[model samples]
Target: MITLSESGVIEKIEQCSNLDSIASLEFYSGILAPAMVNAHAHLELSHLGGVVPPQCGFSKFAQCISKSRNLFSEDECHNAMDFYDSKMWDDGICAVGDISNGSGSFETKRASKINYHTFLELFGLKSCDKTRLNKLSVVASELGLSNSLTAHSTYSLNCKDFDDIVQSNVEGILSIHFMESEGERVLYDGFGELHSWYVECGMHIDFDKYDSPVDRVISTIPSSRRVLLIHNTVLLESEINSLKGHFGDNLTFVLCPRSNLNITGEKPNFRLFSESGCRIALGTDSMASNSSLSLIEEMKEIEGVPLATQLKWATECGAEALGVGDQYGRIEIGRRCGLVLLESVDLIEMKLTSLTSCRRII
Candidate 1:
């Protein structure tokens, strides 16, 4: 039984088979778990929903986003953000680790009932935005949200890009989109379509500048700090082994299966990551690249993993990634964690069937 105070903070927890002894308590037969967490999301991009084409390769998709991001008016984007926030809440997402290229989602986040950790995502094609992070941090702080200055991806961030970002978020949760597509292999030998596009756009870079894009990113961030590596679609097994040995305590992997399939028609090598026994989480990248910001679709699409493990990835691991484990991951005393009920799934067998759906309770 969960005892929630009037203000929604959990006061006590009783581990029992039933709460039948409690006075006038109505109970149902369902499996209770912590509310899900969309560990990596771009709520500000909600306005771009249904605009970008599906199954477009990463390079072309990036171009489409850049060209169409400013098509909507400011008011329209704000409305879309609010609507998307409600959709996540309706789907029982208690917390979100959302990425923000700018401070556009600040007001909606401030008014949201769900918990949010804002990531000020920085990017530069050939240079770094070394000076604008402090101002962005102030905006997040004023809105009363946990914020971090994070890198967008391994390809875009350069040596000069993270001077301010690394210092400001030295000890916070740092997230990066790492090797999300096969095209990212160009950084090593300049062979992929992404490299060809770079040359076409006149964005030249020395492929020999670093051993790998992952190495270049890891060197800039402190090893002691927690780093969430999002999108491991193209990372090699050898690279995973090396990083696991070096950054075990501070590394976590995040998968957005639906987004990956929607863009590249393939998902990450889940078996590879699962065998490593690394901490994992789930997310919906953005509406621009996905059908909707629902974590359920991601959970359903992710196969080869056990249902219990997938649920843990969607909830507890996500909470841990967002730095809210003690308060939001599990159903425990004094946690104040939101709760949801899993319906239609086989509780006895602990399996997720096609009929499975979630119902939010608290």
Candidate 2:
């Protein structure tokens, strides 16, 4: 028998002489473990499932999503959010760093039994200036969400817009979609498939506008704030090494293997990040890009790694990434009782069954 304190700490582990001897004692079966921390997710995009691609490149897939966004109804969006939230609970997720485009899902998130902190995403080629920032601040204040800020990825926002967003210095967490696809890399480097796609889409192409996308954005952003970089499917070892000097303890990388595979059919260099001492976390993304909101499933899709390492990504690493490592990641005393219980299975079987209905005790 194990006793986990309310603060999520493991107080005691009692071993009975035998199962029959412990019959009089109240005990829960299965594996008692720490609650999960989902480091990145777009809950508002859950409604566009099959409408997106099952096996399309990132650029085409993104185009499909843009085209389908207006087709969804308000009630459908609410139902999709509810379904995704329920799925997270079943997988033992206690906290989530969810991203919202606006104030649409604030009521749904507040009514749910999960701990949610939203980052209002802001991105535009020409409109994410002071005017947009002020508007976002007013909306965020009205919703009463504690933390809100302007968000941008390496390939999305221009230099001035990125600077303005960072300059606002909003509280809570700052998240951005990093190198998730080849298109992003191309767009940043000014010489890839996505650059041409951008030009073809009628978006302005200003090659001399700024230096490399990563360098400019990193230079302007405050490194003290906790930053979660999602996907990073195309981030090279050298790039990770360069950030080592700049990122201190406030930067983390979030791996969304299922979403990566669904979009670009590739995975990031996990071995490199693990060896370089980079902080790492796991995210299920959303139902639009992924099948379900199951961190265990994300852990399972990670190939060529040990189970212990993968488990760390889903638990401790994610908590650390979200700046709540001390409170929710592990089964330690004084931490909240956010825990999971997995069914007994061999290592191989455990990995395979992690995605479905493996036992969960939160």
Candidate 3:
């Protein structure tokens, strides 16, 4: 059992019967582990929940979001943000690597108990004022939170915008939507639904200047640093090899399996990533594309993988990625890692069943 001071700071951890507590507590029969971390999320887009349909592909999903994103009032967005933030906390998530296009989440994060590292997102596909990034960066710094200026995705950033964001990403943590779709790379080759979608949307690009989407992005950023590559629904073995050559211990592939399924009806070739010995992590992209923001729901969508490995990805790897490695991710004493119960997960199959649910015990 864990002993928490009235102030919520961790006091001590000891065996249940041996521990003495002046306060009352609840107990349950389940496996206890460190609280989970969501490595990639979009709190700014929470207002767009269920505004887009599943299996429609990222291109169409982007189009629909573009059309309806601004329709919601600030109050509506704030409401969704509050609800989702509370939902993740109740689901045993202790930290999050959340993407924010504006300061919409700044106020909410200021009042939140969960550890948050806001990745101020810069998108070039449409347009973004590069100057605003420093302002947000300063604000995040003043608030005593970890923050990084990051890109929206491989496809959305043009050469100028990508370069600018890379220069500003000094904090070592770079979270990006890497190769979430083939269109990102295929648009360079001149034939794909994504290319067509881009043309129709008037976001045409000159792909002839670069080798491929992934290569172009890799070339622009730092070679040795923690780069949290998100989605990667179509990342290739060749690309993984290239990444390994440049980023040794600095690469982390943040998998959003359920969100990938919801948007594009596919998952990354996770076998290739695992076989390559790539550091893996888990995320709930957003409620905009996914039905649930539960990390357990994301794990349930993944099959043929060891549960322990994914659990490490969801907890340890995620904590490291968000710059909170010392504070959370393990059950060790003095870590302040909140305890959580994994209910009904089958150790034999290493698969999460419907009965499996995460309960916060601390």
Q: Which one wins on lDDT?
A: 1
Scanning candidate 1 in windows of ten residues, the lowest lDDT window is 158-167
TM-score winner: 1
When summed lDDT is taken over every stretch of 10 residues in candidate 2, the lowest stretch is 350-359
lDDT per residue as tens, model 2, 1-362: 55766644677767757866654666643455677888888888888877786768887877787788779899999898888887787778877888877666777777776677677777866566456645765766676654467565766676666666776665657788888876776675666767777777777644335555567556777766678888889888878876666776778889998999888889887788777777888998877788888887787777766667777888888877766677777776566747687655354544545423444564
Ranking by lDDT: 1, 3, 2
- lDDT (Cα atoms) of all candidates against the true structure: 0.83, 0.74, 0.82
> For every candidate structure, what is the RMSD over all alpha carbons to the true structure, in angstroms?
2.0, 2.9, 2.6
Better of 1 and 2 by TM-score: 1
Predicted structure 2: lDDT: 0.74
Give the TM-score of each candidate. Answer: 0.93, 0.89, 0.92
Better of 2 and 3 by TM-score: 3
Residue 209 local lDDT, model 3: 76
